[model samples]
Every structure is written in structure tokens, then in C-alpha cells.
Target chain A: MTLDALIQRLRDFADARDWNPDHTPKNLVMALAGETGELTALFQWLTPDQSRQAMGDPHLRERVLDEIADVLLYLTRLADVLGVDLLAAANAKIDRNELRFPARQA
Target chain B: MTLDALIQRLRDFADARDWNPDHTPKNLVMALAGETGELTALFQWLTPDQSRQAMGDPHLRERVLDEIADVLLYLTRLADVLGVDLLAAANAKIDRNELRFPARQA
Candidate 1:
């Protein structure tokens, strides 16, 4: 699905649960941090191969994806709430980086 | 120090170690995934407060920060190697998201 559609689904999910209030930019940042911790749970002790294979397991993969989606949704909302253009920010930072790490010498 | 300086340091670090060759975009992306796993290790089962406190511990925090730095450094190098502007990409993505989720009705 398109990123737009994915965001809408998250909005619908949050609305159904009345969790939007807790999704203020600041709160969402905190929640992202928390959920990131949860996502990390899946690979606590596994080797790299195990971690990638875990992603192949439907049950485990779904849970991990959900956690990641949770964080991404909150981030999207947070950016939306603050009137920040994530893509713009990313692009601008990237431009600056180009000058810092020029290609000719790299 | 400036972000540029930080990146220069990373370049120096990689060059001294002769790991620049392994920092191709693809490899850096993989390395990032790996370091992310390590960063996540510090707070596998900790409560939110505990996780925050863990960041305050010098040794543990250092390791976690190192892991995070490793990911960021690789990301920077990867972007450098690919000639991709991270900030530009971020900004561009953010702009697209703005149109996808407008604020007035949100």
C-alpha cells in the first residue's frame, strides 16, 4: 500500500482506541522511544541470521512489524501535529551532508 | 562540534580501520541493522524509567551510544558513498507526508 494509505489506517486505529490525545508530538516521541524498546525485544539474543529468519516467521514477523508500525505511526502523527515535513527535513540534512562528505575524495 | 565535524570523525575512524570498503550503502545498511540490535540490548526488559536511567549510566550508556553512533556513522558513510543526501531525502519525504496528512482537519 501507499504510505498515505498506511497512515490513514494508523489514524483509524488510533481513533477507534481514542489514543490520539496521547499522540501529541512530545508524547508520540516518548511513545516511539518506548515502542522501539519493544521492537528490540525480538532480537535480544539472536544472531543476525536468526534475526532475519525471525522476520520470515509470520507470527513473529507480524508482531515485530506491528511494533515498528506503531513507532512509525506515532512519528508520522508527531510530524503532522508539529507541521514538520519529514521528507523536507531529511532532504535538507542530506544536502548539507553531501558538502561534508564530498564524493571525489570518498 | 558541527554535524560536519562529527561526520569527518566517522570518516577518519573508518579510514584508520580500513573499513571504508565494507561501508558500501548495502553493507552500511546491514551494519546499521546489526548495531541497532546491539543498542536494543541494553533495555530488553527494562521499564521505561529504567531504560532512561540506563542511559545515564556511563559504561552502559557509552556502549549504547556507541552502538547508535555506529549505526549513524555507517548511515552517513553509506549516504556519502551513494551520493545520497540524507537531509534532502528526509525533507522530501516529510513534504510528501504533509500532503498525505494535512493539519487543519487533524
Candidate 2:
């Protein structure tokens, strides 16, 4: 499915549950943190190499995938609630990063 | 820009900086947490109503916009590095939610 489709599905899922009231930007951001925390916990103490390698382990990979999806979902919902366009915001930041971290001369 | 274009830009940014070594899943997750922390701090003490209102404040709105971008960029990066398809993962989760939180009859 496309990104927009997935976001709409999230909105629909929440609507189905009568969860829009609870999906305020505040609650969405908090839920985002909770999901991010879970994602972080999975990689907390692994050495850099182990962390990358974890993706190859079926069980670890599933959990990591789940947390990442959760974080993305909540973040997407927060942006939707705030009427902020995430791709545009991210693209703007990328442009800013270009200026902030200018390419070095070869 | 499309999501894939933005992701390619992120990859190029890291490549230019020789930052692939630093973009390990563990480090990316930690960085993701740091950004989410900042986002959470913005809403920490605000009441739900106040939290929603903060988005109406120009300064708060800009910061909120920036933090959400950072969260998305890092998440997109993490997913890319892990070879996990975010749209697919989120789609899978939505499907699970359908079963887990089945819609109630009115």
C-alpha cells in the first residue's frame, strides 16, 4: 500500500474505535515516545554491529519491525491531527541540513 | 519530494559525510529517541487542551514541525538500513489492529 493509504487506514482504525478524542497531538506524541522507547530498548546495549545484525534474527527482527511501525504510525497520526504535512516538513529539514552541513571540498 | 527521494537524499547525506559507520541501527534508534524526547518535552506539562493549543502558537508550531521531521527522517533511515518496508510493516499492524480491536456494533 502507499504511504497515504496507510495513514488513511490509521485514521479509519482510530475512527472505528472512536479514538479521535484520545488521538490529540499531545497523546499521539506521547504514544510515539512509548513506541520509540520500545524500539530503543531492543537495541539499548547491543554493540553497533550486533544491532545491525539483529535484523537477521527472525524474532528480534519481528519486534524491531513492530516497534518501528508503531512509532511511524503514531508520528503520522500526530502530524495528521496537527495538519502538518510530514513529507514536506522532512524535505524542508533536508534542505536545511544541506546548508547546515555543507559538502566539504574534495 | 516523494518519500523515496527523501530517503535517497538521507542516504546521500550520510554517504557524503562517510557516516554509514555511525548510522548503525543502534545509533539511529538512540538518535530517534533523542528527537522524540525533545518533541515530548514540548507537551510534557501542558494539559491536553493546552497541548493542542500549543500547535497554534507560531513558535511552538515551528518547533513541533521540526521535531516531527527529525523523527520521521530518522525512522525512515532506520527502516531503510534494516531493509524493512515501513509501509508493509504498518500495513501489517493495521491488519492486526483490525482483529485485535474489532469494531463494536452500535
Top-DockQ candidate index: 2
How far in Å is the alpha carbon of A56 misplaced in model 2? 0.9
Question: In candidate 2, which residue ranges exceed 4 Å CA deviation?
Answer: none
- DockQ for every model comes to 0.06, 0.76
Interface RMSD of 1: 10.1
Model 1 lDDT per residue over A1-106, tens place: 3444545655665575566666554355455456555756655666644554565577875565455444445545544544444444434444555566565433
- List where candidate 1 sits over 4 angstroms from the true fold: A1-106, B104-106
What is candidate 2's TM-score for chain B alone? 0.94
- Candidate 1 C-alpha lDDT tens digits along B1-106: 3435545666765675576666644445456456555645655666644553564567865554444444445555644554445444444444555566655533
Docking level for model 2:
medium
